[model samples]
Target: MNAYQESLKIKRDNYSALESAELRGEQRGQKQGEQRGIEIGAELERAKAEREKREMAVKLKTKGMHIEEIAELTKLPIEEIQALV
Candidate 1:
């Protein structure tokens, strides 16, 4: 083949390689973003659950529940229950 034709083929191959690389990079970025979103969601859920547990502990404490019983019933640490008192 002529030099002109060979050069064109090389350019086409390079362009194809660049396109493939760009597509792979986008997919990797999307996956990473999805994973980050999942992590944030889990963290939010954990925070909400912790808040609810603390509220319940406070209510139980107001009702004159024993610290040890509150700890056992709520599955919270004894220290945490005592702190609420």
Candidate 2:
């Protein structure tokens, strides 16, 4: 091939390689973002559940429930239930 034709072929090959690398990087970033989003959502759900359990423990305590019973029913630690009193 002429020198000009060879140069054009090299440029095209380089462009194709660059495009492939960019696509792979984009996919990797998207996957990481999705995983992070899932982790954040799970953390929020766990916090919400913990708050609800604490509220229930408080109500049970007000109704004259013992600390041990409140801990068992709410799945919270005795120390946490005592702190609510």
Candidate 3:
């Protein structure tokens, strides 16, 4: 082939390779972002559950429940119930 034709073929191949690489990179980034989002959602749920547990412990303590009774009622450790007071 002539020099002009050879140059055009090289340019086309280069562009095709570049486009493929860019698409692969974008797909990888999207997957990573989705996984990170899921992890964050799980962490938020765990934090909410822990907060609810603390609130219940505080409420039971306010009712003047003994530490042992609180432990029995709340099913938490005696020391943990005492600490709540």
Best by TM-score: 2
Candidate 3 C-alpha RMSD relative to the actual structure: 2.2
Q: What's the best-to-worst order under TM-score?
A: 2, 1, 3
Over 4 Å off in model 2, which ranges? none
Query: Pick by lDDT: which candidate is best?
Result: 2
- Estimate, for each residue in 11-78, the C-alpha lDDT of model 1 and write its tens digit: 99999999999999999999999999999999999999988988899999999988888888788898
Which should have the higher TM-score, number 1 or number 3?
A: 1
- Report the lDDT tens digits of candidate 3 across residue range 6-83: 999999999999999999999999999999999999999988886777678889789886777766766677777677
TM-score, candidate 2, is 0.91
lDDT of each model, Cα atoms only? 0.91, 0.95, 0.84
| Candidate 2 worst ten-residue window by lDDT | 76-85
Instruction: Give the higher-lDDT candidate: 1 or 2.
Output: 2
- What lDDT score goes with residue 84 in model 1? 81
The total of clashing pairs for model 2 equals 0
Q: Tens digits of per-residue lDDT for model 2 on 3-25?
A: 99999999999999999999999
